[model samples]
Target: MGKMKNGLTGGFSGKVGTLVGSSVKGQNILRNAPKKSSKNPTAGQLSHRQKFTLVSSFLRPLNGLIKRHFGSAQKLKSKVNLALAYHLKEAVNQVEDGFVVNLSKVVISKGILQTIFVDTVAIVNKELTLTWSANLVFGSVNKTDVLTVVIYQKATESMFILEQVAERGAGECKVQLPASFEDTGYGIWIFLTDVGLVECSTSVFLGEF
Candidate 1:
């Protein structure tokens, strides 16, 4: 049942007869309702579903990070949706019969703020240290920008995200590995965000750890 709001002339939400009424970008939209059928999915359709599942499952854990930092949300697309669309198209590789996400090609954040350059990444004992300098081909970044680190363990699909770990000008930060993270490879990425400016920089893929 479609309820009338903003007067009878206003937009509505729900189904009436064979037509469905909805709102998009504050605009009232009416379209033919989908017909429910018991048809079996074709091979191509199934393949597409499999691909979507693969990407969605991998990125779901980073929903909070991506939804707030990926990019500006469009009329009908949220930032999380934008991220999914990007990885689905750019980061996936077609395997024998399914798809797998390319970890190196994965991007967690993207925006206008220029990020600091990471000079070196080294591991001492169980502490992972990340160091950077004021050297950028583009230009220097804001010293007040907060740093964010994302560590992904492919073997267990476990992730560690550290936000506001240090200031851009701080030069370095350390992350102590958890015992469960032992004997595993890490895909690490970093980005900087200017809290006052409400802007974030593209994440730097710092190779495997």
Candidate 2:
């Protein structure tokens, strides 16, 4: 065997000196070519990417809400976009045309709404109360800001058993549920929005209540 200046030498069938070369399907190929990493992405990173993409896509239609809820100024709107992109939790996912955010499992400690957590949900006499950790609203939340509540019936495959939008403050709000869905198993989701009622939280789930 004679080694060339580049170190590749001709040899027997499918053998090129130390390297292996072959013709497959009438195409010449190298067997031991430096391969690329197949599993380059960690599970955590992949999951986060998926959540971010889903949230971004869902929020596209609610740009007005983002502007109104966060602020009207262009600088404030930029902050809103960054906050939403960075503060999202892994519990976000798309369901048909809507989304489900499991609030109990979500944690948003980044961007403007730092330490924002949904702590508890209480249902009494068909009225629902949701309590959360004090939000650090960075001049984005206004008096017109509201919370949007949605109840989904998993058994009936209905995306919304009941939907309500109500005025809210920074901490919590209580709303009455329709009597019809009281006995049915339903999932609760809530998102915060401005007066425009378009911008919103990721629609965090409050479990069956």
Candidate 3:
């Protein structure tokens, strides 16, 4: 019985040794596996320094674009302001000539007539007057003709004759308010037919009395 037990133990040891040898060989095969070459770096694999330069170069155009847009916006605003100022000045000048006393004063000569038109709606109860002067031009042959001044106001479909003055060479005319005519815009049309054909027109706001 002891001999049989020893025989059995030795047989088990032999089988275990064979299995260990096979495992060792398999491990060695795995260790000596073929080495795979790494693929070449793609364009996406940029260095940190290169990446920073690329980002900066891309942002340069973006920065320039923003600046250009800002400049264009400022220039457009300037042009709009200029146009607005021009129209505002013209409107102010027109209204100022009728409402303001200092700015209303003007000179008219023989060859030229200055006509200021005021809307009656703006001067209904206001005491408004028109005054102008004319000078004669010297000529060798023709006699100095008197300058004729006519003030007319148009309302709806009809034109009301406010005042007319005819004098030799130089003259002045003035109209008292409240205007007897309807509250329609007044148009001062000055005509110099005596010396030469000259006409001028000015506009004013008219107020209701």
The candidate that achieves the highest lDDT relative to the unseen native structure: 1
- Steric clashes per prediction: 0, 3, 12
Two-way TM-score contest, 1 vs 3, winner: 1
Pick out the ten consecutive residues of candidate 3 with the lowest summed lDDT: 99-108
What candidate 2 gets wrong by more than 4 Å, as runs, is 1-116, 137-139, 158-164, 168-170
lDDT of 3 by residue, 73-116 (tens): 23334322332332333322223223211112211221223333
Candidate 2 residue lDDT tens string, 121-153: 777787877777555555655544556665555
Reference-based lDDT, residue 130, model 2: 74
Model 1: per-residue Cα lDDT over 75-100, one tens digit each = 88888888999998899998896788
Please estimate how well model 2 matches the true structure, expressed as its whole-model Cα lDDT. 0.52
| Of 2 and 3, the candidate ranking higher by TM-score | 2
RMSD of 1: 2.9
Runs with alpha carbons beyond 4 Å of true place in candidate 1:
1-32, 123-126, 135-140, 178-180
The TM-scores of all predictions, comma-separated, are 0.81, 0.40, 0.24
Question: Among all windows of ten consecutive residues in candidate 2, which has the lowest summed lDDT?
Answer: 107-116
| CA lDDT scores, all candidates in order | 0.84, 0.52, 0.31
Clashing pairs in 1: none
**How big is the positional error of residue 148 in model 1, measured in Å on the Cα after superposition?**
0.6
